[model samples]
Each structure stands twice: as C-alpha cells, then as structure tokens.
Target: MARITTPLTNTEVKQAKARDKEYNLSDGEGLQLRIKPNGSKLWLLNYSRPYTKKRVNLGFGKYPDISLADARKLRAEARTLLAKNIDPMEHRDSISNHQKEKIENTLLNVAKKWFQVKKSAVTPNYAEDIWRSLELHVFPYIGKRPISEITAPIAIKTIAPIAEKGSLETVKRINQRLNEIMNFAVNTGLIHSNPLTGIKAAFEKPKKQNMPTIKPDELPDFMRALSIASIKIVTRYLIEWQLHTIARPSEAAGAKWSEIDFENNLWNIPADRMKKKTSSFRTVN
Candidate 1:
C-alpha cells in the first residue's frame, strides 16, 4: 500500500531546523527536504532506476533558495522522464556534454573535420585548393568563432570586401565552401540548422563570360607573333601544336606521342584528359 504525503507549506519549510540526526521532510511523491545535523536543508527527489528499480536521490537545490514549489516542479519533470524509461541524471549529463562540444567546436575545427572526409573524394591538388580558399578568405575572420553561432549576415559581411573587389568567382566559391562547412557542422550535430543556406542571394550574381579564342582571320597575325615571341623552342612547338589541334589547353598539354597514330595521322585525346571526359580525335593534316 502506498502512503500519502501531505503537501508542505512555505511556513513549515522555513521553520524547519537542524536536528541531532539528519531527517527528511516529505512533501509528496519523492520530493523531500533533507535536514542535516549541521543545519543545511537540501531539496532532492527519491527516485528509482527504471529497469533495476534501484532507489537514488537527485538533488534539486538547497531549501528556501529552491523553494518547496520549485522542488515539486523539478520532481514532476524527473518523474515524467522516469515514466518514459529515461533517467533524468543521464538526460542532464547528455545536455551538458552537448553544450560543451558546441563551445569547443570552432569553425576552423569543424572545417578541418569536413575536409578530412571531403579530401578522400577529390584529388590532392584540388583538395589543397579547396582548403586554401577558406584560409585566404574565411579563417582570418571567423575561424575561431563557434560553428553554431555563424549566420548568413556574418558570412556576407566577412566576404563583402572580396565581392567589392569584383572577384565574383572567388566570392562565389567562398560562399559555397562556407555553407559546406556550416552544413557539415549541422550533419555532425555541432549546430541545429544551417544559417548560410541562402547566403548567395545577398551578393550580385556573376556575369556570364565566354572563353576567349582566336578567330581564323586572326591566325596569320597570331602565327607571326608566336614565331618571334621570347620563348623556348619546345614552348613554341607546344603553342603551335595547341593551336593546330584546336584542343582545350588541358587536352593539348596532356597529349602524348603514344596517343598519336603515325599511319592514321590522328591525334587521339583520351577520355581521361579531355573535357567532358569524352575521347577526342583531330586530323594531323
């Protein structure tokens, strides 16, 4: 049979004095005011572990300071957790640990973690370029800031100077990398949401530009200029080959003698080195 406890009043709690031996004043359902012999009154909850049913005391606060009402409220919350089969102490500790992690996980630290995972998917040179972009444009400003506190306004302000310099391409890449880091923080539980989701809209869009190429009518002048240019013989031949084949700079430079068929007189640019990853061939006429 369960024994009913009478609710304690403010007067009764205030009047409680230390006794020769420690004793508890029960208000109701597991909330108790423990009076020690040395005259300290503490409020705590008498609870049982959900599975093991082992009784444990969870302290709310000292009496009067915590008040009888506050103790009862805390006991109710703890009881709610117990009903859910969750230990209140463990829940409190989990929250405390998460807060500590947020404090320690700075933008630079989280970016580094994201990089470790990202670098595996990209080439070493390309990976270096990605990290270098952040170092030059981002780390100097908010690297030490906690990742959880970064917002779109803060990000725009940080990169506004670069945008002002008319380096729209660089700014665009910075915004992308910053959002990637923020999203990484979210996925890793360092932050609740991404604050830079739509940050790109804050800046002017980059203008559409086309790759400059030499026209057929300009070929004679280009050839004359290239012939007299202060460059090495190999560089001269390389430039001529680049223009003759009409291949992309990467495709031209990455060409090999082995890729050329003497009998066929065809320059075969393999799929790997060619843009769009498609093999291209040009007649050596």
Candidate 2:
C-alpha cells in the first residue's frame, strides 16, 4: 500500500522556522514549502512529467509572496495541465516570453525608432517639438502599451479629451502624426496592418478658418497702428519687408545682403531659404 501525504495548515507554514539544513513541509500530493537555513521559504510543486516517468519540481514563488493559498492554486493548475499532457513549466515560460515581447515593443519604444529616421527630414528644433508633443499629449495615455495593440477605438478615446477642449486642430495634427508612427510600425514588421486608418472618421472634421489677412479698408488703420506700435524698429522693417516680398516670416528673416542685386533691383534669395526651395529671384522695391 502507498503512504498517504497529509495537507499542511497555514499555521504550520507560518510557524515553521529554518533549521541547521533545508527542510520541506509537504501539503498533500505535490505542493511543498521548502525552508532553507538562510531563512528563506520557497514554494515548489513536485510532479511527474507527462509522457515520461521522470519527476520534476516547478517553482511557484517565495513564501509570503506566493502564500499557502496561492501555492495550492498553482499546484491545482499544474495538475490540470498534466491531465492534458502539457508541461506546466513550458506553458508558463511561453506566457512569460510573450509578456516580455510586449514590454519591449511598446508604443513609445516604436515611436522612438520611427523618429530616428524622421528627424533627418526635419530641422532639429522641429524634431524636438514633435517629440515634446508626444511626451505631453500621447505618451501619458497609451505610450506604454504594445504597438500591436493600438486600435482605432483606443486612439479615438485618447485624443477625445483634447477635442472636447476646443482644440480640434491639435487633435487633427495628432491623428496624422500617430498615423505616420503606426505606418512605420507596419513597414518595419512590428505590426501586420495599420489599425489607425479610420481613426479620423471617429472625430469631427475641423472647420476651415482662413488666415486673418488685412482687408483693403483695414490697411490704413493697420499701417497707422504699425507706425506707432511698441515693437522694435527692426521688427517693423522685417514686417514691411515680409509684406512687400510676399514671403513668410522665416524666409524674410533669412534674407542676406549677398542675395541683393543693387544694379538689377532684384533680391536673389537662395533656394535653401525659400519654403518651396525653387524660386530664388524676386523683384523688390
């Protein structure tokens, strides 16, 4: 006849102390609390591997952390796996690896990878602004989640708060930026398809508001105000230069004396300074 192993009580587990060497307190069929001389208690489940006759021990966790109740729950799960011809250790190991992969491939991690290539196409200051926007508005919400899990619903929920605050334009820009990041993930094989494709449809389309241009009637007041404005003289000159040359603030500010043709009355700007980077010659008064 086979000897029967009795189940251990929670009191026995708590009162048990480490001795001269390692000792085990068995809780029935397979669960055991192994106490070491170093004052450590570990939960182990001794079981026979399915198919093979050899036995092995599967570690649950340390005592107090795993607790007696938790150890028994794990032991019962291991027995269920054994009944189905699966190795408990291997199954647990597989789940652990998947979780590790998800942590490694989070949204913020993939965004950094995308930004490395994207930064080369833009100015350093613009790149910094782009990253700052992500850190402020997006990262706190879903950046830690895996890139593969960024579905449209989750994305819509994230930016909805911004939209509610009457920043629809900001929300639109964020959507476009996020779409680019997700596309990069797809191209790099991080995800199969871009789940953010239809996310824009989930929100209201931003209404078009044209840039505030001075009307003909308002030109006199504008010039009169500019003449007495509190701004610096150099700033006044640059604004007038921008008005005349029909150039953006950045383009007008970048003008150099070398680009001026005194004889021809032409401002020969460099292609690099222009927004379109093609038109270089402009007639200036």
Candidate 3:
C-alpha cells in the first residue's frame, strides 16, 4: 500500500489514482478518500472498533456534498458516538423503528383494526352494512396504504360518494368509528396524529337529524289512531311506549317481562341494552 501524507491537494489525489486504479488520498488527520474504477469516490476514517482490533466502515456521504473536509467532521461525530458506547448504524435503525411504529398506529390503520375487534358491538343486521361501507367506501380506496399517506384530498374523495347518496347520518357514524380507531392507535404508539380529526365538516353537507318526537298534541291522535288500527301486538306496544316514555324502538323490543313490573307500571333499562346516550334508569310510567 502506498502511504499518503498531510496537505494533499485534490489534483494530487486525482493524479495519484491515474497510475493505479486503486489508491487512497490522505486528507490528513486520519481521513482518506478512496477512488474506484467506476469513478466513484468515498471517504473513510481510519479507526479501530472499540476494544477490538477489527476496523469498521463508518459511512460515506454523497460525493461533492461530503467533501474531504466535511467527511472528516462526520468521522469525528461517529467517533464521539462510539466513545459513548453507541453504534451509529444501530442508532439509525432504532430511529427507523420508531418512525415505523408511528405510521402503523395512524388513524387509518387503527380504524380498520377497531372495526375488526368491535364487530360484536354492532347488531348482526347492521354489522354487514357497516363492514360493506368500510370495505367498499373506505378500504378499497385507501386500505393497505400506509396511514401516514392519508390526506385531505383522499379523505374527501373517499367520503363524497357516500354523502351523495343522502347517507350523511351514516357518514357521521363512520367518522366517529374512525375517530375511535385512531384514538386506540395513538395510545399504542402506532400513529402520532389522526387525519380523522376535525373531519365531520369535511362531508359536503351536514347530516339531517331525525326527529325524535312528535308535537305534544300529535301524540293523542297518534295513539288513538294506532290503538284503532290493526298492528302486531308487540309493534303496537313498542310504538306506544316509545312515544309515551321516549324510549328507543330497539330498547322497547329487547325489554323482557322480568325487567318490567306491571304492578308498579315501571320499567328499568339496564346499561347493557341502552343506546349510546340513553340513561339507564328505573322508569315509572
């Protein structure tokens, strides 16, 4: 090996390589530039691994940007990391892992997984409706794509079709589901931010809220008309109680005789059967 010395110029480095395809240009202070046949040049720092006789390849920056001067500086930093008992490459890998975890926990990924784990939360009749909307409306378009890749444009496009069908209420529900999924993802360190945040207004228009009750005067006529009309006994009682006590239709049907005390004319709704916002109470009618 030809020995290199300090104060070497760029011309000397290039010329010395003309005679021999493989040569190192000593840039003084333990830094050397190695040139290969393909005209590729790399900077190397001469150093021994900590407590070991073996030499290790620190790294090289892009040519020109990492000039001989800058190359030495990087080598010095790498040496510093080594002195602190850290491996530069290992540190880089750790950073990469952290970034990957952030992406995995993004709202999009969490939304999908939440749907999977909470399928039982929704009724069997409505479960498929929810799944189809997510699969065709959301997943096919953005599923398998990284959570970090979701953007406002993508979100708007994905939801526009559903909104056009006058399913604004459904879209609202979907948005809430996405929000919850993203929250779980955030807790798990899968995503740092939720794209679903502030997404309700993104829908083209606000959803139409269904009227929960009729005018007070309309109740008497409604009850009179239903009592005279021929409807299923269960249906008649359900509509009457729903109107009288403002109970949800689903809850009225799931109510058991055991839970109702006819002697007291009172009904008690348990927490398990109540809707999202309904109060669990012992109602006296």
TM-scores for every candidate against the unseen true structure: 0.58, 0.67, 0.52
lDDT order, best first, reads 2, 1, 3
Judging by TM-score against the true structure, name the best candidate: 2
User: How far does residue 184 in candidate 1 sit from its true spot (Å)?
Assistant: 4.3
Ranked by TM-score from best down, the candidates are 2, 1, 3
TM-score head-to-head 1 vs 3, winner: 1
Off by over 4 Å in 2: 1-4, 9-19, 48-55, 94-109, 140-150, 161-168, 186-193, 207-230, 240-247, 251-285
**Model 1, range 64-100, lDDT digits (tens) per residue?**
7898888888998999999999999888889988788
lDDT of each: 0.87, 0.88, 0.68
Cα RMSD, model 2: 5.0
For lDDT, the strongest prediction is 2
Residue-level lDDT tens digits of model 3 in 1-285: 966576667576545442247667767655677777766677776666665646765556545667656786787787787788777656667988878865665545666677777665755435556777677677777776666666657777778788889888777876776677666666656667777788888875564678776797897887799988887887897877776666666777677777787788778776566645344655556
Model 2 agreement with the true structure over 1-285: per-residue lDDT tens digits: 997988888899999998999999999878899999998999999988878857899999998998899999999999999999999988999999888878999999999999999877764445776899889899999999999888999999999998999888888888988999999999998889999988888788889989889888998899899999999999999998888888777768778898889898999876555545565787898
Which is superior by lDDT, 2 or 3?
Answer: 2
**CA displacement after TM-score superposition, residue 282 of candidate 2 (Å):** 8.4
**Candidate 3 clashing pairs, residues 3+ apart or interchain:** 105-190, 105-191
Task: Show the colliding residue pairs in model 2.
Answer: none
Candidate 3 local lDDT, residue 162: 83
